[model samples]
Target: MKISDNCYVEIHFTLNNEDNEVVDSSLGGEPLPYIHGMKNIIPGLEQALEGRVAGDKFSVTIKPELGYGERDEDKVSIIDAESFAGFDQIEEGLLCQIEGEDGSPQLVTITHIDEEEGEVTIDANHPFAGQILNFSVEVMQVRSATEAELRDGLTG
Candidate 1:
């Protein structure tokens, strides 16, 4: 079977950045499985795998827009340190959740600290945001997805 809308696909992949640094991989782990065409993976990768069959191997390079999107300067903010008082530590590189403008929870990474100013710099962009992705993928299986699985936004 070929990977297409409503199909189930199993793939093993190694994702790398422009510098060839390994960003993620299925090494020593089960191949990733997802319902094809359901936005289970990056848009560029999902679209590239369309119509591909099991045992197919290929490499695809995706731009930032189709990957995590270009990094937005506006997503970085400097906030008062007291907002994180509940945390035992306020070290940089810590991941924290803050209330977003809509009152929804937003995940942000601490970037800097200003002891004198009592401020902390945080960035809400995904870690991989603005980076191009180079993927080496091998399709393990491709088959029709069950009706129930499709309804649940998954593949079986």
Candidate 2:
């Protein structure tokens, strides 16, 4: 079956950056599966995979805009330590959630901690933001997606 908006696809892929560093991979392991046109993957990759059939192998480079999006300077902020009042210990590299402006939840990583100043630097941008992506993928399986799956816009 050809991959389309309501089809399920299984693919094994390796992603590398311009630096040739492996950003992610599924080659030496199980293939990742998802529904086509369902935002299961990056926009660039999904668009490239559309209309392809099982057994197809291809490579594509995704610009930052269609990937994780360009980094925003405003996404980084420093907050006083008192904001994390309930935490007994605070350190860098810790993942935490904060309320966004619209009352939605936002995840951020602790990037820096200043003990004397009692402040923490948190970055809300995605880790891969502002970088291009190079992907090599091989389609392993293709199947028609169920109506429920299509409505949910994701794979089971």
Candidate 3:
């Protein structure tokens, strides 16, 4: 079977940043499985996988807009460290979610901690934002989506 709408696709892929650094990979592990056309993966990768058959290998570059989107400087903010009193450790690289302007939870990463300054730097942009993603993917399997999978809009 080929990858298409409602199909279950299993792929092994290596994702690299614009700098050619391996951001992620599934080469030595289980293949990632997702239902095609379900928005379960990035738009660029999903579009590239369309009509692909099992055992096909290809490389594709996804622009920032299609991958994680252009980074917004406004997403980065410096807030009072005292606001995080309940947390045990407030260290760099820690991920947390804060309420957004729309009253929704927004995930933010702790980019820096200013000890003496009593401030913390948080960024809401995805880590990969603003960078081109280079993906080398090998299709491992493709099967018709099951009835339950379709109803649930996902793959088993």
For all predicted structures, in order, the TM-scores are: 0.88, 0.85, 0.89
Please list the C-alpha lDDT of all candidates, in the order they appear.
0.92, 0.88, 0.92
C-alpha positional error of residue 42 in candidate 1 after TM-score superposition, expressed in Å: 1.3
Q: In candidate 2, what residue range of length 10 has the lowest lDDT sum?
A: 147-156
Candidate 1 C-alpha lDDT tens digits along 37-139: 7898889999999999999999999999899899999999999999898888888898889999899999999999999999999999988899999999999
Tens digits of per-residue lDDT for model 2 on 10-102? 999999998989979998888998988768888999999988988999999999999999999899999988888888777898888877779
Ordering by TM-score: 3, 1, 2
Q: Which stretches of candidate 3 lie over 4 Å from their true place?
A: 101-103
lDDT comparing candidate 2 with the true structure = 0.88
- Greater-lDDT candidate between 1 and 2: 1
Q: Give the TM-score of candidate 3.
A: 0.89
The alpha-carbon deviation from the true structure for residue 117 of candidate 1, after best TM-score superposition, in angstroms, is: 2.0
Q: Which pairs clash (backbone N, Cα, C closer than 3 Å) in model 2?
A: none
- The RMSD of every model to the true structure, in order and in angstroms, is 2.0, 2.3, 1.9
